[model samples]
Target: MKVIILAAGYGTRLFKDLKNDRNEQFKHLIGVPKPLLPIGERPLISYWVEALKVRDDISDIFVVTNNHYHHKFKEWAQKYPFVTLINDGTSSNEERLGAVSCLQLAIDKFQINDHVLVIGGDTLFYEDFHLHNVIGQFETIVKDNNYANLVLSYPCKDEETRKYGILETDENHKVTALREKPSPTDTASRQACPCFYVLSKDSLTCVQTFLDEKKNAPIEEKDAPGHLLSWLVGRNPVHVYPVSGRFDVGNLESYITCHKYFQQNIRNIPTYLQ
Candidate 1:
C-alpha cells in the first residue's frame, strides 16, 4: 500500500488566528504551514511519518503541498529520505486545488496502483488509534471483496455534527450515506467521519470519476474529501472503523489542546521512532 498525506491547504483559519493574536510566543507560527506546526517535539505530520515508517505494508510515502510551502516541506523532508513531497502549484487558497483534486494529483504524479492510505496532514487521533488494526480490518474486508474501502469514524456531540462529515451506517457498519456537515436535525447518528481513508486500488479510479461528475457543480460541493466519499458510497462498498476520538487542529485553540494531550501522555502515544 502507498500512503498519501494531504497537506496543500492554505490553513486560513489557523493562519488568521495566529496573525491576530497578541501573544509574542506564537507570533513566529503565523506563516508556518499547519502540517509543519509543532505538536510536541516534532512537526504535526512527523507523527504519521514515524508511525508508518515501522509498517512494512506501506511502500511509498507522498506528501502533497502547495507552492507556497513546497520549499519548506522539501527542506523538512530532506532528513527523511523515504518521503517525497509533491507541489500542487498553488500559492494561495484561492488558487489551490481542493482536497479531492490534490488526492487525484498525488495518485497521477506518483503513478500509484496499489491500495492507498490517505490521511489528513493536520489531524491526529487519541492513544487508542492503532494503524495495524485499521490495516487488519481492511485486509479482512478485501478477502471477501477486493473493491471494499475503509474509513474511520468516531462519536461526536449532536451540536458538533455540522463540523464534520456525518456518517449513517447500517448494522454491519457499512456506510449507507455520508453527509458533509449536515444539520443537527438531519440525522440522529453522531458518527463523525475523519479524513483517514484506506482506498482500494479499484476505488482509486473513482476519485477522478467523482471529480468529472462534479465538474459543473459548486466548488464547495467538491472541495472537501468527504464529498467524494459521499458520492462513492452508492457505487462502492464502504466500511467504517469506529475509534475513540481524533484531534482536528484547525485553529490555535485546537492545536494547543492536542499539543497538551500529546505532551501529557507522551509515553502512551506510539511514535516507533525510538
Candidate 2:
C-alpha cells in the first residue's frame, strides 16, 4: 500500500491560537512546519513515519504540500529512503484542491492504482491506534467483490460532533450516513473520522470521475472527502471501522496537549536532528 499525507493546508485554526506568531503548522509548533515540529526532540511526523516503516505493508510514502516548504521537506525526505515529497503549488486553500482532490492529484502524479492509505498530517495514531485492525477489516470488506471504500473512524462523544465528520453505520459495519461537522441535534452517531482511510483503486477512480464532472461547476460543498464519501455510500459499499486513541492536531488545545502527552509517554520518539 502507498501512503498519501495531506499536509498542504494553511492550518488557520492553529495560527489563530498562536496569535499570528507564525502560520506554518510545522513552524508554529517548534519553529518549523507541523510535520517537522519536535515532540520531545523528535519531529512530530517522525513517529508516524517510523510506525509506517514497522508495518512493512506500506512501501512508498508521499507528502503533498505547498511549494514554499519543499526545501524543508526535502531535508526530511533525505533522511528516509522510501519518502518522496511533491509540491502542490498552492499557498492558499483557495487554490489548493480539497482533501479528495489532493489525493486525486497524487494518484495522477504517481499513477497509483493499488489500495492507498490516506492520512491527515495533523493527526497521529498511537502505537495501538486500531489501524492495522482496521486494515484487516477493510480487506475483508473488499475481498469478495464487495465495497470499494472504507474509512477508519473514532467515537466522538465530547460534545464536539460539529467539529468532526461523523458516521452512521449499519449492523454490518457498512456506512449508511455521513455528516460533516453536523449540528449537535443532527448527529446520529458518535463515530468521527480521525483521518485514517483505505481506498481501493476502483473507489478512487469513481471519485476522480465525479471530480472531473464537478470541477467545471461551482464547489457547492465545503468538505470534498466527506461529500464524496456520502455519495459513495449510496452507490457503492462503504464500511466504517472504529479507531481508538488519536488526537486531533488541528485544534490548538489538542496540538499542545498531544506534544506534551507524547513527550512524556511515547517511548519511540527519536532524537531531534539539529
Candidate 3:
C-alpha cells in the first residue's frame, strides 16, 4: 500500500490570522504551511511519518504540496528518506488544484495501482490511532467486501455539523450517506468524517471517473476529500472507524493546542517510533 498526504492547501485562513498577530515571534510562522509548523518536539507531519515508517505493508509515503511551499516541503523531506514530495505546480491557493486532483496527480505520477491510504497533512489522531489497528480493520473489511473503503469518524456537536462532512452510517458502521457541511437539521448523525481513508486497488479507478464527470464543476466541489468520499459512497461501500477526535492544526490556536497536547500526553500513549 502507498500513503499519500495532501499538503497542497495554501492555508489562507491560518496565514491571515498569523499576519494580524502583534507578537514579533509569530512573524516566522506567518508563511509556514500547517503541516510543517512546529507541533510539540517536531513538525506536525513528522508524527505521521514516524508512525507509518515501520509498517511492512506500506511501500511508499508521498506528500503532495503546492509550488508556493514546495521548496519548504523539499527541505523537510530530506529528513525522511522514505518520503517523496510532489509539487502540484500551484503557485497560490487560488491557482491550486483541489485535494482530489492532487491525489489523482500523485496516482498518475507514481502509477499507483495498489490500495492507497490518503490522509490530510494537517491532521493527526490521538494515542489510540495505531496504524496497525487501522490497517487491520481495513483488511478485515476487505475480506468480506473488496470494494469497501475505511474512513475515520468522530462525534461532533449538532451546531458543528455544518463545519464538517457529516457521515450517516448503518448499524454495521458502513457509510450510507455523506453530506458535506450540511446544516444541523440535515441529519441526526453527528459522525464527522475526517480525511483518513483506505481505498482498494479496484476503487483506485474511481478517482479518474470522478474527475472526468466533474471537469466542468468548480474546484470547491472537489477541494475537500469528503466530496470524493461523498461520491464514492454512492458507488461503493465505505466503512467508518470511530475515534475520540483528531488534532486538526488548521489555524494558530489549533496549532498551539496540538503542540501542547503532544508535549504533555505523548509519553502516556504507546508510540510506533523506535
Leading candidate by lDDT:
1
Model 2 lDDT per residue over 1-274, tens place = 8889877766667766666545544444532566765665567677668767667777788888776566787898788878878788876646766777777789999999788888877777655564467677778878865446788777677588887778888898888888888887886688887766788766778768778767775554523467777767777887776656576677567777888887787765442111
What C-alpha lDDT, on a 0 to 100 scale, does residue 92 get in candidate 2?
Answer: 65
Ranking of all predicted structures according to TM-score, beginning with the best and ending with the worst? 1, 3, 2
Whole-structure CA lDDT of model 3: 0.89
The C-alpha stretches of model 2 lying farther than 4 A from their native spots are: 20-31, 216-224, 268-274
Off by over 4 Å in 3: 268-274
For residues 1-274, write the lDDT of model 1, one tens digit per residue. Answer: 9999999999999888888888666888877899999988789999999989888898999999999999999888988999989999999888878999999999998788999999999999877778988999999998889889999999999899989999999999999999989998999899999999999998899999999999998777767999999999999999999988998999989988988877777674464221
For candidate 3, the TM-score is 0.96
* Model with the higher TM-score, candidate 2 or 3: 3
Error of 2 at 67 (Å): 1.1
Candidate 2, clashing residue pairs?
Answer: 25-34, 26-32, 26-33, 26-34, 27-32, 27-33
Instruction: Give the Å shift of residue 132 in candidate 3.
Output: 0.9
TM-score of 1: 0.97
The C-alpha lDDT values of all candidates are: 0.90, 0.72, 0.89
lDDT of model 3 at residue 16? Answer: 83
TM-score of every candidate: 0.97, 0.87, 0.96
Deviation from native of the Cα of residue 121 in model 1, angstroms: 0.5
